[model samples]
Target: MKMKCLYVAVAAAVLSLAACRSSKDAVSVNDLDGEWNVVEIQGQAVQAESQPFIGFDAQDGRVYGYTGCNRLMGALTLSKPNKIELGQMASTLMACPDMETERLMLNALASVKSLKCSGKTLVLYGADKEPVMLLQKRFEVVPLSSLKGDWRVVSLYGAALPEGMETVPALNFDVTANRVTGNSGCNRLSGAINHDGADENSISFGNVASTRMACPDMDTENQVLSALNSVRSYGLLDNGRLALMSEGGTIVLELERSK
Candidate 1:
């Protein structure tokens, strides 16, 4: 009877040890999934009003986000607990006064070798196992369904109002009809948008058609049309701005929600 009790105790201890190990090794892609706003780089606080952000799309093994001034996309691979690898990244080349911060961010991303998450905070480590970047998970303020409203174009091809256009461009999405119509600053535009299989943060538009109205500002219209046609995905920024991106994850158009 004493031997039986000893055996029971040993079995219980073994089970307890296994449970502890499981808890310590528990890691999942969900831990890294979501939008994370840049808080610090190499222990220096990020001072930009438009803070950079990054997101991990576990479904497609893609990581994308804004780098203060330019949009960036890259490949991400996660191997269980605490093992992560970020592949070569591509970014847009929009000139901004805050290019210094963008450069710092891009450089840090290139050096990232692993990552650790504690609650809503994420820390990226470099080759020497030193923390290089700090980020906090960002929660969406508006639902993706809210994207069906009217939006006023704020920028096209990453630049402010094109040279001669005095009027602002606009885009309107009719979610129920799966159709979109708008003014491309110099022409009337309409198109079919497909959100059928899109997630809350991504969408694609069909071929957009515009009325051929010759205006002195055809330059702006052409830029707008090109941007709209190339849009392959969309994301809403923390400040309520809407970004339309191409397949390569470059921000082609930016807009603001209009009442």
Candidate 2:
């Protein structure tokens, strides 16, 4: 109970000094569907590199998203038109160098009383009905849970692998352990994954180590390792495949969740 109140205080204390803005979009109350990327808090632009986002599932009566530092989730209830109330919130315990963004986000969210969402953009208002935060709609919100389990390698740099290849490289995401274990198609692959689970398609691999084994598929293994090392973010495709994107937004590695 105290922690919850602390969040409210954090938001109120930080946001009270922000210059308020009037709503300019058409009134669309309680239209908090889909995923949204936090663009601004109290008119202060969030760093472009940080991926802070939120998702609302009204039908499920829940809210979830990645804070700038950790994964956060809670309940949602809309008791009146244009009105909102967030239930107690819970989040992961990971700490980061810069937690100000997360603090601003949580503080602003806790103070949200009403909002004007125009389907593409949302402006959250505080108790004074003054805008506290701005959010832009994002396409295809990927749940962290979706990254779990085994994924079969489908393509390398968008090119399909040789047909009938016995050794198919794969990736396994163990979110709980914060580790990635899989095959480079020739060597056993293991590594650490860095993700706040918030930035739009935000994820990266680090300290990847693999067993040295001579195989005819070493070329494939090399390509896979290079791809994994270069991964910058991830995306969920309409076809239900997970795309491990590289620098400049290239789909270096494509994966399908194993059945």
Candidate 3:
């Protein structure tokens, strides 16, 4: 009887040590300290939109990443043994023209409950649909500063306007002023904005009230209204192209600053 008890105690100690190691290997912010890309989003198709995921220190034991359209930051807590929870992530106020795609990415990340490593792929899933963030391991990121300036629009979405409606006209957005005051296709218009000084990426046009001008091209007029009302996020991309991308790479319009 005494010999059996000794063996049982030794076995328990070994099991406990193994459990500790497993828990340590679980997913945490420390493990996700580098860049990542969206290899597979929402368990549907795989679209690697953002090249490199940028993770920066939030000074609060959390990590932040730059999605193609918006800034994402969240908390990570690793409970014992296969139990993990990715806290609610907060994003900047940029209305994506492609609302569908942006919503999917945000929803996936928000749904991360527990994560596991499958070879080189890091899969994140939830016990339920609470939050879902599935990301693949990625490499370094190249910081670009050329993406800064006033951009204009080239295209838009939504319904066509009446004969005299201006959805959105030729716009010249000044990031320095944190304002987007420009010609609304026909009339002069202006509104507030928020700029990312480091990258010139900005957002604006919430509740923009413009002068009711009667233009010959009602399409332009209706477009002007849609642009202001639907303006969500804006970014300065390569080649001096300022893209006002909506919910899903939907380029509401692309404009160039005056050289």
lDDT values for all models: 0.77, 0.77, 0.53
Residues 1-259 of candidate 3 have per-residue lDDT tens digits of 9988986675445434311133235443334444445665766654444332434232245656655667777776654334555678887777755556567777676666666544334556767733245455443222223333444555455223233334445555454555566776676776776544454333546546677778767566667667665655555444545556443334465666654
lDDT, candidate 2, at 78: 69
From the highest TM-score down, the ranking of the candidates is 1, 2, 3
lDDT by residue (149-199, candidate 2, tens digit) is 999999997688878777799999998887999998878999998886556
> What lDDT is reached at residue 103 by model 3?
72
Best by TM-score, which number? 1
Candidate 1 pairs with clashing backbones: none
Candidate 1 per-residue lDDT over residues 78-135, each given as its tens digit: 7545677888999888999888889899899999987777666788899999999999
Candidate 1 — which residues are off by over 4 angstroms?
A: 1-27, 34-40, 44-77, 87-113, 118-121, 127-129, 135-144, 162-165, 196-198
Error of 2 at 227 (Å): 10
